[model samples]
Target: MSNKNPSTTRIVELAKQKSFNTEKKVLDTIKSMIKNKKVINYNTVAKESTVSKSFLYKNTSIRKKIDMIRNEQADLKNVTNHKGNTSDKSKDVIIESLKFKIERLEKEKQELKDALAAKYNDFYNNL
Candidate 1:
């Protein structure tokens, strides 16, 4: 016979079953939301399922499924080219951002060089 009391074992089993049922319920809620094209975020899932938001975030598998769906949905909104690549607008945006960054960096570099030249002139005069 096991060391644990029968009642305690029964209680533990019931708790485990409850947890499993709740997980299933949450998953079903997510599926229904997907079928209905509803948002699949933590708050929406929890609200639709009547479960706790913490519970939705706390469960690893459920969290991953939600994240995967949400990310896939977000990607659907992007403008893609024929080969499922970035659109011209997206490329243009990326190019503009890089150009801005390069210009800013070049300005900073010039400022540094000017400061260094002034410092060198002072050092030479002092020597």
Candidate 2:
């Protein structure tokens, strides 16, 4: 029969509690990071949360959540890119056209000012 000391049993229980606490803390940190829109990949989570990558992979719920978030981000990027291409081109064209119109109007305003100044000089000379 194996000998089991009371002190040794208590020590083992304490160690298990510590391990569970550490895992819970790390999981909470990971959730907070996700809520804050920080990176959610294995390496980033492991680095930011001080949790091992192996531990994250071994935990099925955490691994699934990370994968789902990553996939959603990827899908959002693709959709944005597809929609933005056409809109961006049109926006660029409109902006350039507006800039050209403003430049032309400014030039016309300067010409009118110069003409008015010349006419005033002529009127003063004739007076």
Number of the top-ranking candidate, with lDDT as the measure: 1
Per-candidate local distance difference test: 0.89, 0.83
TM-score for each candidate, following the candidate numbering: 0.56, 0.50
lDDT of 1: 0.89
| Predicted structure 1, TM vs. truth | 0.56
Model 1 lDDT tens row, 1-127? 7757446778899999988999999999988998998868898998899999898888899999999998988787564423558899998888999999999999999999999999999999999
Cα lDDT, model 1, residue 9:
79
Could you give candidate 2's per-residue lDDT for residues 1-127 as a string of tens digits?
8657535878899988976886777778877987897867889888887878998888787788779988987887788664435687798888899999999999999999999999999999999
* Candidate 1 Cα misplacement greater than 4 A, ranges: 1-7, 80-127
Q: What C-alpha lDDT, on a 0 to 100 scale, does residue 73 get in candidate 2?
A: 76
- Could you tell me the lDDT of residue 80 within candidate 1? 40
Q: What local lDDT does model 1 show for residue 117?
A: 100
